[model samples]
Target chain A: EAEVAQSPRYKITEKSQAVAFWCDPISGHATLYWYRQILGQGPELLVQFQDESVVDDSQLPKDRFSAERLKGVDSTLKIQPAELGDSAMYLCASSLPDSTGELFFGEGSRLTVL
Target chain B: AQSVTQLDSQVPVFEEAPVELRCNYSSSVSVYLFWYVQYPNQGLQLLLKYLSGSTLVKGINGFEAEFNKSQTSFHLRKPSVHISDTAEYFCAVSDPYQGGKLIFGQGTELSVKP
Candidate 1:
């Protein structure tokens, strides 16, 4: 089965440093998502993309976080000036254009801010 | 607006025992429900989903969930579980009209003891 791919399985950064996470969704998927998962909580949506266009980012902290899926295939999520509270696992998911709400997720990048 | 609530934060059960994880949602519009499982150090995997039609949906790994519209509930159940089944389960909801951005519950940690 095809799987979503992610880079930098783990990242450690200073509180004021910048960090980026990458994801490659399964081929032919038109929708992509970025999510943050705290230690004991479920994944929370940060941004969503539809064929290279942003569909929803209402919950994204635009001031410090930004995500892009330029060609609507792979995506990148960047966080500048990371804070301690920003430490978490960042997950990326994707689905087909006519998805029935089923999602395929990447392994995720674990971030830790010191 | 849509929100998901996972009633139990943790459920401890012995291997080969039945397990049930409860989930409820509140939504004013038509919605789709989903259940995802995350093993340690991994990303979320689709367990099952309820889009329409049958109230009871069977998913991979011998898991099943029943969607109750009147009660606003979608509970997951498994006849028997194993130690490998220990993981974090999450319930999520999405409004079909909102471009498929998911709202997730806190999560339920299923600890299948040997």
Candidate 2:
């Protein structure tokens, strides 16, 4: 029954502002992920972490977005100079190990940039 | 590379009616498939997954899916649905070689009318 935890269920900010979303994965999980869910579309991976090391981030917009799992447990995703198109639900998920193919997600933080 | 496709953008059904959500994928290597449900204002929840062995996998809330490797399809079906079942469903695929990075399809919204 352990669930991934996310903070600030809703966020609103102006363009060019900075915003951050936080997530705490289930205990013992080793892989963490950050995804963006635009309205009317499925979630897209922004970054992924294996423990404290970044595994994949090829799709991440590095110039504007950054994510880190400092302790290999909780993670934070930050976006600087937010754009209107950046408005979306930021979801965090975690799994026990790679290739499990089962993930537990947190109740995403919905961001709106004006 | 792996990609998923959800054929229906939306499916409307009355309460207690059976429903099926179509999902397909294209992959060059071995893959795993998963179905996730998202309630309004909430994060994604794993509905089911197909890793190996069984062609038919049963998941939470009485939902099931069959993995057709030949057809590259993994369709979700439920015997009966309720108003609470109204939400968005996403189909995703991951290549084993990619370390479980998921590629998702455009979601299918299931509107269970009362």
Candidate 3:
């Protein structure tokens, strides 16, 4: 099956360090999303992209986080000066534009900030 | 804007027993509802969705959900669960007004004991 791909499924870093996660969406998918899930909570959208262009990032903590999909197929999310509170699971998902609104997700990157 | 609420935080059930996970949503515009499952250290996977048509939607892993617009609820149910079914389940909402951005609930952990 065509699944969204994510890398570095697990990462541990100390505070004030930098961390990055990458995602490759399914082929032909036009919408891609990045979400964060606290240990006991559900996933929350951090950013969204439609064919290499950002569509929504209203909830992103912009001062510390930045995301981009330079080629419209794959994406990278970066966090500078990571804090302990940044420990969580980062999930990536992709879907077709104006479709049934179903999303296919990657295995996700689990980040732990010390 | 759309928001989802999973009333139960955790549900403990014995193997072969039926389970139900409750979810309620609030939205000003028309919306779509979804249920996703997350095994330990894994990304979220779609379980089922309710967009239109039949209110009862069946999904993978012997799971089903019923959408009740009057009650503003979409609850997930599994006739019988297995130990392998232990995981966190999330309920989400998406609407066109927000550019198809999905909002998720706090999640409900289903623990199936053998």
Candidate 4:
């Protein structure tokens, strides 16, 4: 089965440090998304990409977070000067352009800021 | 804009018992609904979805949900549950006008006791 892939399954860093998560969506998928799932809550969209272009990022905290799908196939999310509140599970998902909202997710990268 | 609400924060049930996880959505326009399951420390997995046509949608692991447009609800149900079913369930809505950006609910934790 073609699946979305994520790396650094677990990461722990002190506050004010830098952290990064990576994701590779399923081949041929035109839409990619990054979500954050805090403990005891559902995932929230942080950023979305459509063929290397950012479609939506209103929810993203641009002051500290940045994401890019350089090739439109794989993406990287970076957080500089991470805070304790930034600790969460970073999830990556993808779907075809016309999938109508069906998404396939990766195992996710869990981050913990001390 | 669209949002999802899961009425219960947690549901505890004995093994082999039937279970229902209530989900309600609010959207000014037609939207797609989905249910996703997340085991401990794992990424989300799609359970099912309601796009159009069928009011009742069957999904993996003997789970089903009914879309009540009049009530604006989509509740997930299972005839029998196992201890392995313990996990967090999330209800999400996606608006086509928003380029398929998904909005998730607060999540319901299902704890099936053995």
Candidate 5:
């Protein structure tokens, strides 16, 4: 079965440093999402992309976080000047354009800010 | 707007015992429901979904969920569980009209004791 791929399974950095996570969705998937999961909470949407265009990012903290799907196949989420509260699991998911709301998820990238 | 609520933050059950994780959602528009399981330090895996058709949807690992539209609930149930089933479960909703963006609940931790 095809699966979404994520890089940097673990990341540790200083509070003021920068951190980035990458994700590659399964082939032919046209929609991609980035979510943040706190220690005891469910994942929350950070950004969503449809092809190369962003569909929703209202919940994303643009002042310090940025995400891009340059070619609509792979995506990168960057958090500059990371904060201690930013430590969490970053998950990537993808789905077909006309999907009935099903999503395939990646293993995730865990970030720990000191 | 859509929001999901997972009734129990943690459920402890012995191995081979039946378990039920409650989930409810409030959405102004029609939406799809899903249950996902996440092992420690990992991303989520889809367990089942309710898009249309029969209200009872069966999924992997002998898990099933019934979508009760009138009550706005989609509760996950399993007749018997094992130690391996211990994990965090999430309930999510997606509005098809809003580009299928997912909104997840707080999550329920299922601790299947041996």
Candidate 6:
């Protein structure tokens, strides 16, 4: 079965350092999403992309976090000057252009800030 | 605006027992409902979805959910579960008008004890 792919399953960094996570969505998927999952809480959207264009990023903390799907197929999320609270699971999901709200997610990249 | 509410934070059930996870949503525009499951150290997976179909939707893993538009609820139910079913479940909503950005509710941890 085809699945979304994520790299560096785990990451640990010191506060004020930089961290990055990568994701490859299923082929032909036009919409991509980046979400943060805190321990014991649901995932929250950080950014969304429609192909190579951003659709929504209201919840994204632009001061420290940035995400881009340059080719609309794979995406990268970066957190500069990471804070302790930034330690969470970074999830990537994708859907087809005619998606009926169904999404396929990748095994998240776990971040631990010290 | 769109928001989701997952009533239970955790549900402990024994093997072969039935279980229900409640979810409610408030949305100004038409929206789609979904249920996602996340295993420990893993990413989220789509459990099921409701989008212009019969109110009762059946999904993988013998799970089903009913969409009550009047009550704005989408509750997931499973007649029997196994130890492998232990995981965190999340309820989410996506508004097409909002460019399909997903809004998620607090998760429910389902602990299926053997």
User: In model 6, which residue pairs have backbone atoms overlapping below 3 Å?
Assistant: none
TM-score (all chains, Cα) for each model: 0.97, 0.97, 0.97, 0.98, 0.98, 0.96
True contacts kept of each: 0.71, 0.82, 0.64, 0.73, 0.67, 0.65
Q: lDDT, candidate 4, residue A4?
A: 95
Could you give the C-alpha RMSD of every candidate to the true structure, in order shown?
Answer: 1.0, 1.1, 1.1, 0.8, 0.9, 1.1
TM-score of chain B of 4: 0.98
Residues A7-83 of candidate 6 have per-residue lDDT tens digits of: 88999999999999999999899999999999888899999899999988889999999998887789999999899
lDDT of 3: 0.92
Regarding DockQ, does 3 or 6 come out ahead? 6
Q: What is the per-residue lDDT of model 3 for residues A1-114, given as tens digits with 9 covering 90 to 100?
A: 899999989999999999999999999999999999889999999999999999999889999999999989999999998999999999999998875668889999999999
After the best TM-score superposition of candidate 4, give how far the Cα of residue A52 lies from its true spot, in angstroms: 0.8
Off by over 4 Å in 2: none
Clashes of 5: 0
Model 5: per-residue Cα lDDT over A13-99, one tens digit each: 999999999999999999999999988998999999999999999999999999999888899999998999999999999999987
- List lDDT for all candidates, in order: 0.93, 0.92, 0.92, 0.94, 0.94, 0.92
Model 4 segments more than 4 A misplaced:
none
Scanning candidate 6 chain A in windows of ten residues, the lowest lDDT window is A95-104
- Scored against the native two-chain complex, candidate 5 gets a DockQ of 0.79
Q: What is the interface RMSD of each candidate, in Å?
A: 1.0, 1.2, 1.3, 0.8, 0.9, 1.1
Q: Which clashing pairs does model 2 show? A: none
Which tens-of-lDDT digit does each residue in B18-73 have in candidate 3?
99999999988889889989998888888998888999999999999999999999
Per the 3 Å backbone cut-off, how many clashing residue pairs does candidate 4 have?
0
Error of 2 at A24 (Å): 1.2
